[model samples]
Target: MQDSDSLRGFLFDNMPIRGQIVTLTSSYQEVLKRHEYPSNIACLLGEFLAAASLLGATLKQSARIILQARGSGALKTVMAECASDNRVRGIARGDFKVCATQTGFKDLFVDAVLAITIEPLQGQRYQGIVPLEGDNLSQCLMGYFAQSEQLPTSIKLAASTQESAGILVQQLPNHAPLEQSTTDWQTINLLIKTLRAKEQLHLTHNDQLYLLFKEHHVRLFDAKDMRFQCHCSRHRTARALISLGEPEIREIYLQQELIDMQCEFCGALYSFKKPFIDALLRDQNKALR
Candidate 1:
């Protein structure tokens, strides 16, 4: 279980390629426990969690990456976010009973578009959207890289109710000769394609890479721990409420004395009473003035 709830990076010493592997156990279960999801929806959420973790490792600065998809079918929307610090949270919204009846990606998500959003702690945020044209989440991600990033990338993702795991390999700007780099990339991709779901779920990070690239010299990096953490707080939630404007706040207050806000990612609740709301609005009015 060395790989459980951890992310590790690797480099191909002989080639200009790098990769990362992520496995989730306790964190995956933590997300599942917050809301009741169908088995299939839960599995898809796991893949998204693993994918976000793998993508977060690629960021050069402190940031958070979100992998989200929206559709008009039984599966309405699913989102997973992972920060540079490896804090992860995810949610799915749809009819679970209807979602359980479907199995294929397309069936579950008709007319779906996958969006990858990166929010840096300091810089502006960026997002890329692509049609969900592939058979699985892995293929959709590969298409996104090919279309948006223009990088040769290979991704494998697998998730069961018990565990979720993913691996991402990308060919960096060519350092080797064209022919050699092409051959190396193809060789590595072929080997990675041979990886089995069972191995991805059960093997240690070292063993998994060794099993795939024993013939090549691969350098594995130290493991980084990951955990389930919701970024929601009373302050953040209050800020969100303040965005509704004074009129909206007044209207809501007329219906109820306390404004209760509950986080969808984690079930933490934030309640704002009349006095607090009044002070908050006064501060906002002063700032505006």
Candidate 2:
């Protein structure tokens, strides 16, 4: 597909290395439209969305990859999540005025902790946390890999007003001994580092990859589309209400004739009236029998 919002995976012909490049246009804009975020926070959320899509490409199950950062700085919390089906969404909550003045990672997120969570569809979940010590998100992610994954990984993330994009290159475990003189991870990383934000946001995915790895024996695969989707629905909301139980639901309904629930990710509202709540409770009770 020639769509701008797509993720492409590639690998070297000879080396034990793999990479993914993703560009977000509509998906990024969808997230921004849900909230009135400042330019800096919007850009940061875009970068996180791209990073999540890139990282989510490595998943083997119908799981999810969540990238989050929380701190006591201008940007209080940022979350980006991508499902195994390539559905992506993101949100940011923070001081917009403070974020407007910040330009650096540390400046925007002081005393921050970056956490990456991998939650499978039907298995154990995993999470890795690292201090936000780098100048940029890419560097912090590389540090996470170094400490938690013990892998040679490089990431270049960028975000603009109209689009967001990122590229990830990782050196896989070798299956056989290689000559010491062969090209190393550092060399490949240098090549990936040359990507610029303007190019990622403007250039086509194929063109961007060609510009970065044209010299290397790169094999590009078909692109996968990334979409902005929220998993929230009436059924899920009913389940949540059921978990709250009858008394809590009654109390909430008493405050207002209709209980309104707004989805943080999609801005969709779900309303529950007394009749609906009673029906839901009855259904939940029947299921418990």
TM-score of each: 0.96, 0.89
Question: Candidate 2: where are CA atoms >4 Å away?
Answer: 1-3, 176-182, 239-251, 278-289
Cα deviation of 41 in candidate 2 (Å)?
Answer: 0.8
Residue pairs whose backbone atoms clash in candidate 1: none
What tens digits encode model 2's per-residue C-alpha lDDT throughout 1-289?
2557899899888678899999999989999998998888888999999999999997768889999999997788999999999999999888888798888778898899999999998989999998987988999999999888566889999998788999998888886565531366767888888888888878887788789878778898998988999998998977776788788888887788988888889998998788988987888789889
- Judge candidate 1 at residue 249 and give its lDDT: 90
Model 2, residue 113: what's the lDDT? Answer: 96
Worst 10 residues of 2 by lDDT: 175-184
